[model samples]
Target chain A: MAPLEPWEKVLISADFTQSIHGRAGCVACHRGQQSPDKDTAHVGLIPDPSQDAQRVCGVCHGEIVDGFGTSLHASLQGYRTIVYSRSVPENHPALDTAMQNHCLSCHTTCGDCHISQPKPVGGGLLNGHNVEKTPSMTRVCTACHGSRVGAEYLGKHEGIPGDVHFREGRMNCMACHAGTDLHAAEGDAAKHRYWGDQQPACKDCHAQVGRADDPIPQHTIHGNKLACQVCHAVEYTSCDGCHVAISEKTGNPFFKTEATYLSFVIGHNPWPSRERPYEYVVLRHAPVAPTTFEYYGENLLPNFGLLPTWTYATPHNIQRQTPQNRSCNTCHGNAALFLTADKVKSEELEANRRVIVENIPAAIPIP
Target chain B: MRRVGMLLLILGVGVFLGACASQGISTPTPVPTAPLPEAVLTPLSQTDYCVQCHTDKEALIETAKPEEKAPSESEGVG
Candidate 1:
């Protein structure tokens, strides 16, 4: 997406000044002097007042602010869960420094979504400070989640069609992930995104799936054995070996990943709990290594091998029919499509053992 | 010593009378009025200074700097 011009970013429309939010006046939230002089007026101005949501937005939106403390977007508990898993308490200082330098910039605020494009994408008002109840799919959500989820959902990847929900149904992220889910009060205890029940699950809308009387024989046959994405999702990007550091020359934080390639591999369920009880699920290679935080300090992630580099995934490039489910023989006995012993890197073998399939299903005999 | 004592007594009487006369002649305290009720100012009650300059497209264009491409790192790590 093209960045908004400086003039375009701050231009408030005449119509907006008459709206409910606009009527509150800029100084009511922004808290700057009402002087005519630019320098004098901006003496104590807050560029993005919603950063302190409770104090600014809370005057009217108290209920939302009350629950926002636990929201995944605000707490960033998922990132902390993954990073903390690979480090000991003693090394947390260095790991935290690395996160501050490299990760926390993606930390979002209320205004980041409702008012403007995210800061990660060079913030500008979406429409002259007019607050949008539903954020723009192209500008707000995808602006940050662009690399994988956004790419797959929007079909930005070369030759790959966009998700069926997007291409056919025209469903936005909010269509499935409602405001309640995003601002969930239950999010405080969540270790990761997949911590609880499969939210916005395929079964939620497609309730006929996996039922005994279901028309699709494959759904019944594969009941509780395979994840929906395992058969429905097409190829998605998998990354490897991401290292982070503060650039000595520029004094800016930077990261480099070894490679990113398209792959569709099914692996044993890493976490088969009550919510996600599938025996098999799609997996993606995460961009992490023991030396990822070396720039912060040596051996920062001494327990890196404790967590697998290849983690459970639900690719957004879903289709009604995919190559994996083309026929019985396509996925069965297909070693290439399975995360077998040979598929994992030699160094990652130990970490990924639980998720690696030990035996491939035999191919059905041709009648 | 008696004369000095008499003079000191006169000075003390004069100082006391002067203080009394000053207080009597001073302006009488005005009657206190009820404190004004807190006004219930509505939203957008005040003139928004931020909107004033920001809405001026010509001024913004004049001050606009050349756009610089965002760094790759800002694109984010997986």
Candidate 2:
């Protein structure tokens, strides 16, 4: 980029008023921090990306700062925790510099933890602490992941149900779960809320099984865990009963019964085991996988990564994750999984081999 | 001698006719019915078409050559 004319540079700097007032301009925070300066304020202000903001972020995010002081992450910061532990004979092998890569990033500056920010560094009174007024916070994520996959996950809840509107009547990733709804009062305050555990599992939202929209009342009544896949079989897409045979006389048009194999539902997301639901949706068709807690039946929890982010925050971090169980059952109450078919279907076993047709729902379009 | 011979011939003819009366005649085997349409590929749900249609439009909107965007994911067509 060519150097800006002096007057033009001043004009651009003036335009960033909000950054000036709300976040303050770079030197106010960096105060003599800029390099090669003969000025005295520059000494401690030299911001180090490899180390904590010498001017801690606690100056803002006060609650987080206070919380961090006691956090697992804070313990590391306070010398209570140390990185590069392989040299220490007492330390476990699992912990090394790479371990710092995991915990440090979650609690530190984006540049230090994730990707580096674009230059012209937006230095203001805040020095380098990011106010994140960028029109697209997603740019930060994309710098790390690239525009495709990371772009999809960047926007809050934008990836949810609306995403499903495109394909094969798929469900949105966020529709069955809670999403980041925008209300001016709770902007960044709710940033970590939507992606966290507060977001429900697909089963929890659609646990009531009946017609596509209605929950099975009988199943709910008996307190049976209503895993949707139970009655729904995976093998044959559509069943045939009439033993269809082609007519000898009417040879003009071919006549015969037919069915197809569905790899999508059958193998979409594999079950932790069999004896689970037959008819299922792995991504969203709730039954085969967990919908709620009883689906858990007193199992241990899943990792913080598996549950929504909010579940792991603060006092919520009660459960420890186990290997087998995942998704919602790792956190919330188990309702749908306990229900039975008779309790669900509202009658005795229905006849099989009867060819049937189901109306699939439509997905939303987001340009 | 001629009368005896005539009587034997009549009895032989009657025995042959009687044997023919006891059972039915032979016939050809019947054929099987024609088979149904093979179901290797299922007709896609409308939701699937929604994906295809939008995907095409999105491709056009983003790049006339979506193949360029994710060369590995889609067809190489421009």
Per-candidate DockQ values are 0.24, 0.00
Best by TM-score: 1
The 10-residue segment of model 1 chain A with minimum total lDDT is A182-191
**Tens-digit per-residue lDDT, A151-232, candidate 2:** 2332222322212222334433223322122111132122332222323433454555443455544334323232333222
Name model 1 segments beyond 4 Å from true: A185-189, B1-47, B65-78
TM-score of chain B, per candidate?
0.32, 0.30
lDDT of 1 at A165: 98
Worst 10 residues of 2 chain A by lDDT: A309-318
Q: In candidate 1, what are the lDDT values of residues A208-264, reduced to their tens digit?
A: 887877899999888899999999999999998889987776778888888889999
Chain A TM value for model 1: 0.98
Scored by lDDT, the top model is: 1
